[model samples]
Structures are given as structure tokens and as C-alpha cells.
Target chain A: MNPAAPRPAEPSASAQAVTELLERSRALTTPALRAAVGRLAPPMDTVAAYHFGWIDADGRPTEADSGKAVRPALALLSAEAAGAAAEVGVPGAVAVELVHNFSLLHDDLMDGDEQRRHRDTVWKVHGPAQAILVGDALFALAGELILAAGDDATAARAARRLAAASRQLIDGQAQDIAFEHRERVSVDECLTMEGNKTGALLACAASIGAVLGGADERLADALDTYGRHLGLAFQAVDDLLGIWGDPRSTGKLTWSDLRQRKKSLPVVAAMAADGPAAGRLTALLTADAKKSREEFEDFDEAEFAARAALIEEAGGRQWTADEARRQYDTAVGALAGVELPAATRERLTALADFVVVRSK
Target chain B: MNPAAPRPAEPSASAQAVTELLERSRALTTPALRAAVGRLAPPMDTVAAYHFGWIDADGRPTEADSGKAVRPALALLSAEAAGAAAEVGVPGAVAVELVHNFSLLHDDLMDGDEQRRHRDTVWKVHGPAQAILVGDALFALAGELILAAGDDATAARAARRLAAASRQLIDGQAQDIAFEHRERVSVDECLTMEGNKTGALLACAASIGAVLGGADERLADALDTYGRHLGLAFQAVDDLLGIWGDPRSTGKLTWSDLRQRKKSLPVVAAMAADGPAAGRLTALLTADAKKSREEFEDFDEAEFAARAALIEEAGGRQWTADEARRQYDTAVGALAGVELPAATRERLTALADFVVVRSK
Candidate 1:
């Protein structure tokens, strides 16, 4: 049973529930996001608009795949969980979306990725300098939107949470970049890096609305823990898809992470495993690294398939799937520690399920 | 006399007065700035420390030439002008400095500049990815610092001001990059870019302290106007130094802007002049542009010197000097519109005077 295979047309109740939540989030959040981005000056504004899928390269309007809007959904739901109307969380939602996209724009440039969401990246479309500038603009706009969202104190608290998470996100990117050059990386170190790269912002998104709504630290921390675990689960699933998911669904080539030589969870876990398979896998990767010293892109598909098989034979695939399930359970368990409404808890739980099972 | 020539050891009264204020501002602001940067995780903290001259690249302590701290002085003094103690403005000062340095780090990479303040730039020493990430960390730190500084309302207001200025600064950079590709840039266009690139942040620095101190918009606006004019004056003088100043004093090569084909104030002003020399300059620049299309750095010293002479003969240098003095007068005049303690008013005036006439 390949997890990446297409499912039946009839969606499960949990999946249906999350689809509505995400749609609602996009409906409420995109306008605020548009308004904030509209405040930017030309060229930077144009680059950002193109980046956000509001316009095409020639400046014509087009509704493209912006993203899943999962972070915004979490923010809005977090507000509802705190007993405030979802409207109260709009600013937080917009700010988180902006930060997420800002990171995406810069990351695409730094990672040398030419495409995102089936379209050319900002850097590829409008030179690298514009990519850097537009990203900076969006980051500034995020801070501005949060700061102006409410009374001075509430806004400051919300902004502080967002800022801390953004710093962690950047630090994570630095660590990920550093990891690519090292020959050995522990599973723990890889998890820590992923926690910073993916978990920090998700945790902030899950609780920033509560912060804005003046929720107590204990409740917010519980939500934060839930989001963090969910992010790790999300990443674990993503790692699995990187090697095995269908290109039609994932919008990536087969063995994408392996090709990029990313020290993702499965790769690290596989390397850490004991057995002749793991040793053979390590030796193969070492030889590949040496052979691809000048051009990593020249590796053949058969070689990648062999590496994937080796990772699976060494139990990396099973370990990652188990880890994803464990993390999802822990994430759902976190909501139980806080006295959230049953409906809110169910919705959050459904969102986590959607994250783990997402094919794209 | 050459305006860039070193001055005598004996300083004038106004210069002496402003020097003491800057020293005092740095003394108060550095500890807070250091503390804010210290909050960053390792690698980022290390890169930022090296950039700030707090530490050498090898991780040893070294008090290198950190910048003049002019923006922080303006912030601290703005607080005092609003009837608050200078300490009340420390956060604002630190935030502005952080934003300023953040731009510098990104700008150095975007501009491909290897040196700043006589040392290798962050990108040069640590590579482009770290430069980008560390700059982002600093920018996030700036927002966090401002938001945590005071009551929610005050902090939010201050953060909004910083955010607006930051966006404008980014827009200016975008425009500057665009100008490099354009064949003609008007003097007015150059001035607007300079204002956005240089004036917006200066304006924010001059007013953020007052915003933090709970001053009304009237006083803040007045200070903003003052700083805007002062910044233009500073840029005009900087344009002069870029072309004619002693490299030893300015820490740049002679004809630096010319070598880069920067359409700075003097070049724009000269091209706009209705004279044979201006026409000849334009033609020469056009030919040079075509010749150096493949390699911009290949222009000889004789060509740059000739371009500089043509600009001066066409009245670019004289016009820029007059413009700098005019802006300085206007900046000083803005202080008179707002009622402030006489000492505070005098200090601002002295600072403006120093900016217009400084050799470096």
C-alpha cells in the first residue's frame, strides 16, 4: 500500500471538516493579506503580487495556487479555541501567511529552486535582487500588520510571538544549510533542525491568535505544543513523499530530497541504523557524494531508486511512518491537556490528520 | 579647496558639541544594542557580532570601527526633545540601528560590495546565504526589541513607524537596482530614490523616540521632516565624496560612484544641465556603457577622471554642494517649527551642520 497513491473521491469526515476550515481561512485571510501587500511600492509590490499568485508575470490577474493556508487556519481556529470570534484572529492569520511566503521566497532563492506551486519562483522570474527585496518587504509588512491590529499591548504581545518564531525559522534554515555539508548527522540533530525550520512557525501560528485574544500562557503553551508536534508529523510525512510520492501530486521529481542531498529525517535515520544494509547505504552515498562533487545533478534514476531501496531495507521508511504516527498522536494528546471546546479540539485534530495525510 | 581634505585637529564649536552628543549616544546605546544582538542563536549571533565590530571574524573580541551611530543619536535626542530622558529612547535607538545594519548587510550582498568600514562585508566573510539569514535575524530582532520596549500602545506605534520606514528603505533599494539598468535617470528621480533609501529610515529614527515617549503626531512629524532634509543633505555630501573625496578619508576608491555608473545626485544634475560639457558627458557615458556591457569593472582611471571633470565642468558638483547646504538649512529650520528646549534644538541643528560638511 503506497501512501502516496490517490485516494477515493469520497472524502472522510475529518478531511471534509479540514477542507472547510482551510477554505474559510483563505476567504478571511487573503483579503487582509492583499491589503497589506498592496501597501508596498511598485516593482517590489509587483514582484510580491506575482509571488502570491495574485498576478502573472506580465501583471495580468490570475488565481493561482497560493498555498494551503494551513497556518492561517490554525491561527483562526486558535482564536475560536480561545473563545474569541475568528475575526479577531484575521491580523495574526495574515501576518503568519506573510511571514511564511516571505520565507518561501528567500528560501527558493537560497536553495536554488526555480519553481514553486507549479510556477516560476520570484527569483527566477524577477531577478535574485528583487527576490531578496520583496521578501524583506513582506517581512516588514507582516510586522506592520500585527502592530496595527489591536490595542498597543495586545498587538505587541502578538508581534513578539511572531518575531521569535521567525527568528527560529531563519536559524533553522541556517542549520539545514550547514547540515548539507557535513558527512554525519544524528537523528536528534536532524529533528532539532526540522523542529526549528517547520515546527517553530507552526507553533506560533497555533497560539498567536490566543495571544492576541489575551489567552493565558498555559493554554497558549498547550496549543503551541500541539502545533509543534503536528509540524514534525507534517515534515515526516513530507520526507516520505519526497522520495516516494507521485510527481503529479507532489510537483517534484522522484527522490527529490535525495537528489538535493538534503539531510532530511529518513536519510539521517537510515544512516544511523545498524546493519549491513545501513553500512552499504552509507558507502553508496559516500561514493555518490565523491562522484557528484562537481555536479550532483548528473546522478541516474536507477541509482536514486537503489538508494531509496537501501533506505527502506534498513528500516528508515518504517521508522519514519511510525514516527509520523507517534507525533500525530502526541499532537492530538496535547489538546486534551487544555480545556478547549470539543468542537475546537476536533477541528484542530482534523487539521493535524490532514497534515499527516496530505499528498501535496 | 578640496572639500574632502582632512580638517585641522582643532575642531569648531558646533562640531565639538555634536561629537560629544554622538559619543554619549553610543555609550548609552551600545549596551542595549549588544544585549539585543546577544539574544540571537549562535552562528547568526557570531556573524552579527562580526558585522557590528563587537567581535572579529575569528570570534575574538575586537572593537573595530562600528559605524558612527548617527541614527541612534537622532533617536535618543528625539526622545529628549519630546521631554523624556534619553534612556527612554534606547529601545528606539537600538531598533533603528538594527534595521539600518540589516539593510547594510543585504545591500552589501545585492551590490556585490566586498568591503564596508574598511573590513570585509558579512557576505564576503561568511558567504551569501549567511549574510541573508543573519540580516533576516537582525530584522526580526528589531521588531522584537521595539515591541517589548514599552506599553503595548507605545510599542505598537513605534513598531509601525519602524516598519513603514523599513518598507520605504527597501523600495529605495529596488529603485536603485532598477536605475542601474536604465539609460537615463532624472535628477528628481535620483532625489526620490535617495530620499527613500536614506531619508525614510533617518526620518523614522528621528521620530521613533518621540513615538515611544507618547508624543503626538505633530511633534513626530516635525522631527521626521527635519530628519528627511538632514538625510538628503547627508546623501548630497556623500555623493560629492563618492566622486571627489580623498579615498583615505572616505574609505572608498576615488571616482567610486562613477566607476559603478551610479546615477547619483551630481551625475543626474550634470546630465540635466543645458551645456556642451553635459552633452559630451552623456555621450561619453553612453559609449562607456556599451563598451563595458560585458565587464563593468574594466573602465580605466583616466576615463573615470575624465567623467568626473565633465560633471564638474557642467556644474554638477557646485549644484550638489548648494543643494546640500539648502537641505541643511531646511532641516535646521524644521526644528524651529516645533517648540523644544533650546539645548535640544541647538544640538539637532549642530548635527545637521555636521552631516552636510563632514569629510567622510
Candidate 2:
């Protein structure tokens, strides 16, 4: 540290701007999201309401924690960057949110996740059949919402982007499932899978606003690249939190990812590392498989915590943290090629920083 | 007696025309369907290929039993009815076939069905996770294929119809699930569910070609009506087959739907009959429920056969047969309102007849 340099002030201007933008975006996007979901069939409508944390399992209205609305915010912000009214991007925001929820609903079922947002997942509360169908409904509704936009050209372009992204998202999910049964997954393969599973949707969300706002292809593509990198950074941060974050903050059980033996980015990278720690970690994983099924089932929280520590010792934690920073920087750099409004650029930079820095 | 009445020729003119139409439609539509599915990412692409019986689970190219391609034929025929060449409806055909496969994939998972089209279902072969994902991929691809059509209006209209039908289909599936837990379901409710589950997609298929062909709303809607009633007739025939069908011809085990205790139309109607036979059927059902879980599990084919006989004795078989004919008549009546080429009209009539009479 430079002895002459003063400490930065608290509540930095960028942080304040991001917080306000998130707040404003959510305020506008939520209503549109709700309206779009309301168009689902009654069965899906009920499950979706519960899944979105807008209602309790009994169908009574309740306030529960929902997601941060980052993708929707990106859609609206991208529209603003293209010099269009943010309100014009509301449908795009709604479409992205719907697609996001569709993936969440189906992914939770496929992954057998029991809890989300500190509440029972839709599959747990409503059952897997309903969860599956509602997910399908939401996927269809996402397209319907985009087509609801008045201009045929805009709707067609937005729908095409979403359809392409969804195909990539499903492919990514298939790859993820396949990776589970595999003993080895290359770091490159993992990154590509993550790009498709997470990055594709975010890229679509970012480009949707531009497509709807009639931005030129170059600017839209640039924004999409920015979002893809941002998504990579976001996922890396999520992987770190999965292993190290407090359960209370993360809304999951202690060492949840470790207990499930999820081949998350950091773990995959560490497993591929050429070091004693990597060998030891591999031995531990193989040893667990060799144990009696009952023994594997009886493994405790302490064992999971130890596995997390061992992963960190293998250099995974630091590697992923550094990777997150690199991706964040690259994402921010992509914005430089496009001439966005000053405020839009500031908000986007803040968003990129937020993706890597959030606690949960 | 009508012994003096002459028997009609076996292969009626309409039947001959429809057979030729179906064959021609398949030749055109299969290529388009293949192209659309080819766009899916790997894993899903592979599973989907297996599901469509184009390949084996080991990815070897093998011929397998696929569905009758009825929906695609209806789509192309309807396009012809609306004064467009069959080639003009290929996209609509592809879209309907994709959606049909999507439903089959998900429904197999939900129902825990082990076999389809004389082979292991996708869920059984590729695992449920991949089946679910591949279904999702097909659904997305369906939308993409429709939107890939050059005209914005046609794409938007076709996409909107598909989205609406998907919503209804999901709702019907939910109702079918709900009906399983109930002691009794009325005939009206069963009809409505069947209409949604089967009719909605068929209606969309029938109307899509017309919509894309720029047919007037009145003619388009009439064809849709025709398709809906045909679907109802088809379901009624399916219920009849569930209890009385020959296993060899149906490609299913003896009384398969009865073994599963599906609340098929005939069963629901029989349960509501005002007769002593209905009382006996009710007693049989209650007796099955009253037995211990082990005792229920011990019941064998004889018991299932007895139950089927009782249902038939209760007049379910006769009522459903009559209802199928009623719906078939109504479907044909709807077609009479729409002007069409004689060949197209003959093909449509043959299709409606075929739906009610198909053995598998």
C-alpha cells in the first residue's frame, strides 16, 4: 500500500449506483414478470406463484426471498445502453426472467434439490410432475411474452435470440448431467459447459434489449460478449460460495456442494491440477466410492467440511478467485468497444463488479 | 336383417387417398423433422435420435418403430385443404411432430412407463434426466422451426397457436395426475381433460398449416374444430382399446391401461352408470382398495381380466364405442362446412375415420 494514499470512502459511488439500479430494475421488472406468469394455465400459475416466492404452498400470498433479478436488470440496462427507453425493455426483461425460472424449476427437479430461497422447492412442495410441466409452461410463456411485443420484427429477433440461447442452455444441462457419471472432465470442457449453461442465457438477456431496441448487430454482439464473460465470473463466484460461504447467507446446508460431490469449476480445476493436493483429493474421492454404500451414506458434516478444506489446499480456491477476477476484468473490457451512454457504462461496470464481489 | 344390403368395398376411395396422402406427407415431413432435430446439441441430439427410433441407445444407426406421424399428416393435409401445396406446410408438420414427441417424452417419465413404440422409452433408455432435457430441446426446436419460416405474420401466428396449445396440454396433464388420487371423476371432467391433453395439440396441428397458408379465419377455425373432435374420438377409441385390445396388435401387454388403473373415459363413464353392473364394478374397485398393500400386489392377470369384464358388463365398452362414433360424426360434420379440393376433403375424411379405428 502507498503510505500517502488515503483509504477509499465507504458507499463508493459505483456501489451506490448499482444498488439503486438493481432496486429500480426490480421494481419495474417484477410487475411485468408477474403479468407474464399470470398468462400460464391455472395449474402452472399456482406452482409458478409458489416457486417465485409470491405465494405460500397453501396458495396464500406471502413475501419470500426471490432472486436478485440480475439478468432482467441486464436486459433493461442493455436497452438503456442502446439509447432506448428502459420501459421498452420490460417485455424483454420479463421474457428473460421467465426463461431463468424455467431453467431453475427443471434444474432443481433434475438435481433433486430440496430447497431454494430458504423454502421448499417446487418439486418438493408441488411434486415433480407439476414442476416439470410448469417449467415447460414457463419456457413456452417466455416466447409468448416476447411475441406479445407489438413490432413483429422486434418480437421475431428477440424470440430467435431466446430460442437459440435456450437450446444452448439445454445442451449445457445435458453436458452437466453427463459429467456427473464421468471420472474425468477437462477444465476446457467444464468451461464450455458452464458457458452454455449459464453464459448463454445471460448473453441472451443482454442482447434481447438491444434486439428489441433496434441496436446494430455489432453493438448487440459486443454486449452479448460482455454478458457471457460476466456470467462466467458470476458462476466462479457462486462456486466459491458453494464451498466456503455461510449457510445462513447462501440459503443452503453446510458444505452442500461438497456433500453432493458437485464437479463445480474450482473442484474440477483442482482435480486437474498437477500437485500432491490434487492426487490426495482424487484419492479421497475414489476411496469414498470404494467404501460400502452405507458408509458413503453415513458420511457426516465434518467429512464434508474437511473435503472443502482439502479443495482449498489444492489451490482450487485461489485459482477460481483469480479466474473470477480475470473474467470480470475481461467482461468490463468488452464494454469499451461499444460506445454506450456514460451512465449505462458506469452501471454495467458496477454490475460486473457486483457479480464477483457479492457474498451470496 | 339387412342381408340384401351389399357390403362396401374394403379399401374405400377415401382410405386409399388418405394412405397415399400419409405416405407422401411422411416422405416430405420426415426430412424437415430430421433437419429441425439435427439442430439440437449433442447428448440431447443423441437421446432424441433414439427416442424418434432413428438410432439405438449405443448411437448405432438402426431402424426402429416410430409413431404413425398422424399429426404431421393432418398438418399437411389441412394445408392442402386451405389451397396450398403440401410443401408449404412442412414447417408446420415439423413443429407438430416435435411437440408430440416432447409430450410423449415427458408423459413417459411422469407415468413411469417403460415401453413406447415397441421399444424402451427414452427415459428408460437414456435415463430420466436426459429424457426431460431432450424433450425440452425438442420443444424449443419446434418454436425455432416455426419462427424460421420467412413471413413474420405466419411465424408469429403459428408460434402463438403452439404456445396456447402447450399451455392447455400442460393443464390437461395436471388434471390427469389429479384424477389419479380421486375416488371418482365425472365423465364431463374426463372429456375436458382428454380434450386438452389430446385435442389441443391436434387442433393446433390442423390449424397451423391453414394459418401459415394464409387461409381465412373461418376455414382455419373449422379445421381446428374438426381436429379437436377427431382427437376426442381418438381418445375414446384408445380407452376402448385399453380394456379390450389384443396385445399382439396393440404392441402392449394385456389390458395395460387397466393394470395401471388409468381413469380412462370408459372407466369413468362405467363408474357413473345407473345399473347393477356399475354396483358390481364399484364393489370390485373398493375390494381392491380394502385389501392390504401386499394383498393388492398379489392380484394377478385373472383379477385384471375380471375387472375388465365387469367394466364391459357395466356398459362402459358400449357407451365409449358409441361416443367414439358420435365424436367421429361430429368431426366429419365440421369438415363439411369448409370448402376444399375433393382430394383434400377425401383425405381429411379418411384421417378422421382412421383415428377412431386404428389398432395401435
Give the number of the best model, judged by lDDT.
1
Work out the TM-score per prediction: 0.93, 0.90
In Å, residue A16's CA in model 1 sits off its true spot by 1.8
lDDT of 1 by residue, A1-360 (tens): 234222244348878999999999999998888888888887777889999999999999999988889999999999988988888889999999889988998899888899898899999999888888899999988888888777777887888889888988988898888887788889999898889999999999999898887788898899999989889988998999998888888989989989888778888899999999899999988776665545777778998999999999998888888888888888888888788878988889888878877888
How much is A257 displaced in model 1, in angstroms?
Answer: 1.2
lDDT per residue, candidate 1, B1-360, as tens digits?
Answer: 234222244348888999999999999999999998888877788999999998888989998988777899999999988899988999999999999999999999999889999999999899888888889989988988888887878887888889889988998998999898888999999999999999999999999998877789899999999999889988999999999988888889989898888999999999999989999999988776675545767667887899999999999999998888788777878888788978888888778867877888
User: Highest DockQ, which number?
Assistant: 1
Off by over 4 Å in 1: A1-11, A213-216, A286-296, A339-341, B1-11, B56-60, B293-298
Q: Which pairs clash inside model 2?
A: none
Residue-wise lDDT of candidate 2 within A8-99, one digit each (tens)? 34436756878888888899899888887787666778899999999999999998988888898899998998899888778888888888
* DockQ values per model: 0.69, 0.56
Contacts from the true interface found in each model, as a fraction, amount to: 0.76, 0.59
Model 1 DockQ reads 0.69
Model 1 TM-score?
Answer: 0.93
